[model samples]
Target: MKFFTCSVIMSVFLQVCSQNPLRYWTLLPNILVVEVNGSLGQQPLSCLGSPQEGTRKDDKSQGIIWRKNGVVEEQRGNSYLVQLEESLGGGNYTCHREDGSLVNHTVVLIQEDQTERRKILVKTDQEDYLTCLAQNYNGEFHCSWTWNRNRVGKVALIQVGRISNDSDAQCSVDVSTQRWTCSSGQSNFSCSVDEHGHRISCRDEQHCPYAEEIQQIYVTLYVRTEQFLVENYSKQFYLAEIVKPDMVRISEVNTSMIEWSYPSSWSSPYSYFPLTFQISQFRRGCKGCDNPCTESKPAKTLMVHFTDVCQFKVKHKAKAVCVRAKDALCNSQWSEWSHLRLRRNNKNKHRQNDKQG
Candidate 1:
């Protein structure tokens, strides 16, 4: 039912957007976005001569003019102090030289009402719009989200820290590097958005794998739509809970025996952080030949520890083997199956893989 409503809103928006492209130009990368709480009484915006320069802002005093949505505004000199008692300030403000040359521009977005959960991105098959995963306990993770069919959005701000109430935590993006950094007392994290703009990879430099996690990591993503609307989504978790091992790399050792190994992306000191492998094998004439792995009974199932054993003996009638792995210490997601078909002839002809039961 929610999806149906989104489709209806999308159709209506498409018709309105087609008629005016420049009016919705806030989606462009050139303009900066400022999020404001409309409930606040007043706000001040400065029209700096070198606005893009971080350290030097609001330095322009002479020969400066301000305009809101391309309309000239005579609100004091180089700066406009607007009242935000009821709504988001002037839609988009651009600073121009006295001769009308463009200097810098910004769009002000009123933060969405948290209770209503305004729609900027519709949920995918998942219950939520965001999906995050970590390959190992290396203090690194990546989060991704799918875009809506009718809306184009970009990451306007990212806030990450150990506590959700970290009032001093601030984030800033470097467009040239495509990287952003968040500074907080508990943890300082840096993230880089991918070129495609669909995903963000972040790292916590202070992570210690040897110690237990006492606090949760909190992450919030602020996305702005083309129509100057903004919405925020957040998540919190401990890295261990989100760790997912990569697929196991299985290879045929010989016709009578097969072996498997850990994924390359897994952390070192295999014994300290071991993996538990599950192997399922089936006979050539198994009951479910069409989907052998799922239907066939595993000839042999072994839960071998890395330090103890990594190989398994194949059964005489076994035709194929499927293997997967998970963190031995923690109950986590399983890796994808590594499969291989065995040959009755010499091992060189083609070796069977994974030690089944």
Candidate 2:
């Protein structure tokens, strides 16, 4: 019975040790040498148990107690040591356990030193529109105009002649209209910087030329007003009387047929005037010559004769003119003298044989 009781007690003790593994614990830096005399002890003890298990009633608690330099620096675990020296002044320090459930030791924490603020510079091309931007490591900065009144805001500046603005950062000047306003013939323009302020100046109306040529070519005349006044505004004036083609004349070669054409400015689809030619031999400078040709009406082209009685003789000259009339008044221009030279009999016979062959 006695042996069975000792065996049962040993079995229960082994089971408890195996189940509550927190009984074995380790602490870092087992020895702390201090410069002052103090008393130390551990309190508010806790456990570092396995993650798979919750707090068990059989879990063992371990701690430490020591003294140094009249101050208490309590630590926990086995093989602990504390030494006292004279260098460290009197102060209160506390060191907590890894789990923060207990105070293990104490040391004073001093404040760290600081560094100076950083500075940066920005630059760009002077010819371009003024634009400013800044960025830093912390991604926060401020931008403002340091020179010109036109660019007084955070944005860029644009100034052309008298027009100035901050929203649109580019300046443009219309030099063509500037010349017309100054009544100048020739104009030169240039773009420059106003560095006294930060404005971009576009200069115009400098070194202008004469006035007569500028006034004559620069006038804007509308063709629509002339058409409106001729058609809609005036009822008494008709277009047929004002828009007639001048220099009308006529000519004839023989009695059988007549050929005619005109040199009027009346273009296609606007006017189509035909001619009628009458031929007569009134006066002559020599043989086979017809002179002093007159027309009863204005004809369009020259007259051609196809009759046998009016066969063209050798070395004969015929004159004709194209004529067009309006309101019984005719305008005429004469054509070049049409020399009526007949072909030889042998040439005509050869042409007939070539056609037949």
Best of the candidates, lDDT: 1
lDDT of 2 by residue, 84-123 (tens): 1222222223333335444433322111111211111122
Error of 1 at 63 (Å): 8.4
RMSD of each candidate relative to the true structure = 11.0, 41.6
TM-score of each: 0.71, 0.16
Counting clashing residue pairs in each candidate, in order, gives 3, 29
Task: Give the distance in Å from residue 357's predicted Cα in candidate 1 to where it truly belongs.
Answer: 35
| TM-score between model 1 and native | 0.71
The list of candidate 2 runs beyond 4 A from truth reads 1-236, 248-258, 270-357
Cα error of candidate 1 at position 352, Å = 18
Q: Residues 220-307, candidate 1: write the lDDT tens digits.
A: 8878776666777888888877788888767778778888778888876788788888888776545536656666667667666664
Score candidate 2 by lDDT: 0.27
